[model samples]
Target: MKTLLSTNLIYSIMAKEAFVKEAADDILRLTEWIREVFEDGGKLLIFGNGGSAADAQHLAAEFVNRFLINRRPLPALALTTDTSILTSIANDFSYDLVFVKQIQALGKPEDLALGISTSGNSVNVVKAMETARAIGMKTVAFTGGTTRPGGDLAAVCDLVLNVPSDSTPHIQETHLWLEHVICEIVEKQMFGTT
Candidate 1:
């Protein structure tokens, strides 16, 4: 049991280290983009499917509700959070159109569209990014390693942050951490240390 615990801890540390080492530059780019968006009063629009959907909502909440600072709520929306819109779009158009439809409705040239997908190829996320780009919104994608479908979506976005791990668990863990760090940076930049 002791040996097993130690091995798991070592693996976790190694996984985190690999992610940080490979993705440090990408993380900084994301932080810079978020700061730019906030400075320009541009909103953030985020979406995904399943676990990625939850992650999208989590990230939006951090920006809209405050991450580590108490200040005015930032402009951020999780398209995945609205059951009515989701169902209506899924019913009228298609599941793949759900996010795209929302983007068409709410996105503007000054806004930012953030899509999260472990595989990077989620059709809905890709569609939304396409729509965002068509309308001149900046696109950001958080994806797993190079092999996943989500990586394709990352190709379309203005900036892509692909965590180094191919394993879903490790990828998702890194995604959560990256999201938290982004929120903290955005918050601090927006509101200062006070």
Candidate 2:
């Protein structure tokens, strides 16, 4: 058991290392998108399910509050935050429309929509991205690498950060790291802070 645990630990780190190596350019591009949204005075609407939902909330908090800097709050919102809205939407329009309805109401062309899903195949997430595109809102996705036929959320998103791993916990870990990295870069660019 101990040996297996150690091996898994090494494997997870190696997976993240490989993903970061391959995705450095995309991550930087994502940082630019985030900076652009903030510079343009647009807010972000982020959402997901399960562990990804947690990531959405965590990342949004970092942005709307502070990540590592003491500058003004950036406008970012996690769509999963409001339980009342979520339950009401689910009841009135089905779970599929939960995010799409909200996006339809609050999203604008200048805003960025970020959808997080480990498998890149959440129907609701994909639907929301589609709606964002139709509305001219820039869309981003943080997902584990996807190979499913026609189930790839990346296909609809303007930017997709696919962490190269299948383990949900490992992928979530990488997602958190990438979010922090992006937040740090955005802060530096938007506030000129190190």
Give me the candidate number with maximum TM-score.
2
In Å, residue 29's CA in model 1 sits off its true spot by 1.8
In the range 1-194, model 2's lDDT, one tens digit per residue, is: 99999988997897789778878998999889889888898899999998888989999999989988998899998998888998999998889888998899999999999999888889889999999999999998988863552247868998888877777888888888888998899998888874
Look at candidate 2 and tell me the lDDT of residue 4.
Answer: 92
Write model 1 residue lDDT over 46-65, tens digit each, in one string. 99889888999999998888
RMSD of each: 1.8, 1.6
lDDT of each: 0.85, 0.87
Please give the RMSD of candidate 2 to the true structure.
1.6
